[model samples]
Target: MSDSEQPGPPEPDDSDPPGAEPSSRRGRRPEPIGDGVGAAHRTWLEPVRSRLVASGLTLDELVGRSGYSKTRLSELLRGKGYYPSWEITYSVVRALDLPPWPLRRLWTAAAREAAKKQGWIENRIQAVQPLGLEQPPVAHQAFTLAMRAPYAAYARAFLQAEDRAQRVVRETFDILWLTWDEACATADVKRHAWQMLRSRVMARTLQQDGHPDLRQAAFFTAAQAAIIDLAERSAHINKMAGFFDAVARLPQDQMDVIVLTHLCTIDAAAVPGIVGLSPAMTHTLDHHARGALNDLYRQHTWE
Candidate 1:
């Protein structure tokens, strides 16, 4: 099927935490989010909830500070109904006196997972109207530029959205900029920066049966190959799905090596640099990933 024709994952319901006070209670605790797409909600909301409790501001006080209604603030805190837009989220973030950068990154990821339109995300962000992050230091500029395309390539493969992937890459670089002095002092800054990028992408990536969802990625592969016919593309996607399921079952390091090498088409030699592994360790992971896939294929085929 074509990219537009593919169905989105079902939205999970928001539930209150166990034994928590009712939503109307003054001291009610925030809800806990489980795995899967909920991770997107959890990442941003958990921090906000923590800060809200820390601030000891009643809902009424928060409403006054954020200039939003108590009902809206309650819904956002509870992760109910629709995902909150960046503008409102930022208002709450500011009300709690929380730093904007980290929350913004997490909020963007959740927005993408909610399938918010790119234009909508952009307009909401623009409505906030704030100063941007500082430019990367001169020393970090060359390294950041060189890695942008490859980092974005890996991010795009997992995220399935150009705007989301680019935003993630920008956030990763922003983080690297903030810690450039420490990163520069590390034994391998390329490896350090890559890990930072990988963590951000994986945080936003969808999950299937506890593994990163590779099935969604198959759609992009089919598109890039120009497999325009619906029947042919469907067959191709199914075949790739099985392969990627096997790929996802490998050890995390091996899986990263395999996806970086095969899916993103990064060179074998270059992968060690990006993944922050020694050349020998990268080869070992590549070998094990292939062997594991073979074993899985044999077991599945035999069954």
Candidate 2:
């Protein structure tokens, strides 16, 4: 059979009422809109969908308020088809009276994950100007300053460029600013901020065989602190490669602790604050991580 003759997914019936599920699509699962990005971006969509329900407005009402067709709104709400453009997404956001910047950030992230080009993303976002969302609160500014260096260090260790690291940190801070109230409500906002930074950096980090590929960072050796003779430096770099590979294989919690304390050289006393763990717990994880690395080293030596 020719490609053009192959059956495609059913199209929604325009005759169906604005909010009604198309009969053709009934009981058929919609393919996820942005599964390429992972679940975090999709989690951000849940609340926006809930907002439509919370408003108690029918789809017809949202159509009028958002100036978008009901069918379009339905697809956006269901995450059924193409990842909606920020222009349409923001219009619904405004109509729902929800906060815009956070959704915008998430939407942008999902769009990127969907492989949308930068020019398209930028053009869509420029359609709506978000006022009052531009300014970060005083507390956010203070936190950003205190956390900026360590966050950049952690990001650079994974991402390997000053510009990329700075961009990731800035995006993390912007997200933190949007969610400051929720972060402050937690036991430690610093830890909350760190997780946000970690998520952004790790999203950009390369993967190898289901683990983060940190071996590349080891070869990019100018960022390392140690200074040694030429031959020694080469040997040291090779040693660091094995160390980073081992670190990459560590469990998530252990890897976080190792990256922050051992690689970035943040003080152990301060780690609990950034990781949102109790000091004793941080110590335990660190000890376990060291033990695991030692075991890996011994196994390599034996082999």
Candidate 3:
């Protein structure tokens, strides 16, 4: 056959052969897609879709009744997207005039299964297990570990009072005892516990100091005084009191960033994970904190 007349390789087939896996454009096995939640979501919604079809409900009717776009309703019925939010699911159930109980059960199961598969729950359990907190002997071991954790310093600096910090840590462990299952199911269990303690300490300190607003409180002076008292009582005290005092005066968000980054020596990237701020927000807070610290030093003539 002449070059021009030569037959091209067989046209690519769009359909896969029976029992064959799907291939991607690069001819590799298609990457597993979706967060597995969508599969459970789809499975759960299948019966609801069947019910809608059997009732002769049209997309137009569903859209009008549920106030969802046709595309959204189609996606929900076809299970083409992430698990639908509760609002979407409930709206559809109401629109279909179906008993909400059955669908609600399925939806809840799907959501829970998806959460488990994502490791959000399992990772938390693992985090606690390593600390031996999940067992009944949690009292002695967990309490000792929590008391000695480096993050404890961050809490003390945040509260500006050793007594208050100790109280907060104790209460945090009590809470962990009460909510052991929940703690084990949470993502970043240690961070969650630390945040809980920080919040409690902040609240108590604010109340006792009558600061009304943490952002406006003169925490620097208070922190310096607290650190000075510690320095007087303990031979182990260091000059870092001045630095922590400056950290104390920062706005709450900025203060949190400094404590997590400097005192805890956490990575800048992981600071956000501990403090529950976005990376951008954490960076902004860190910048503002450093600037504020410099301004404080200049004002105090601390060379």
Deviation (Å) of 106 in candidate 2 = 5.0
Error of 2 at 39 (Å): 8.1
TM-score of each: 0.55, 0.71, 0.35
lDDT of 3 at 37: 36
Worst 10 residues of 3 by lDDT: 22-31
Top model number, lDDT = 1
Q: Which residue runs of candidate 1 sit more than 4 Å off their true CA positions?
A: 1-135, 185-187, 222-232, 298-303
> Quick one: RMSD of model 2?
7.3
In the predicted model 1, the residue pairs found to clash are none
Order of models, best lDDT first: 1, 2, 3
- Candidate 2, residue 83: Cα displacement in angstroms equals 4.6
Q: State the lDDT of candidate 2 residue by residue for 186-207, as single tens digits.
A: 8778777777788888888898
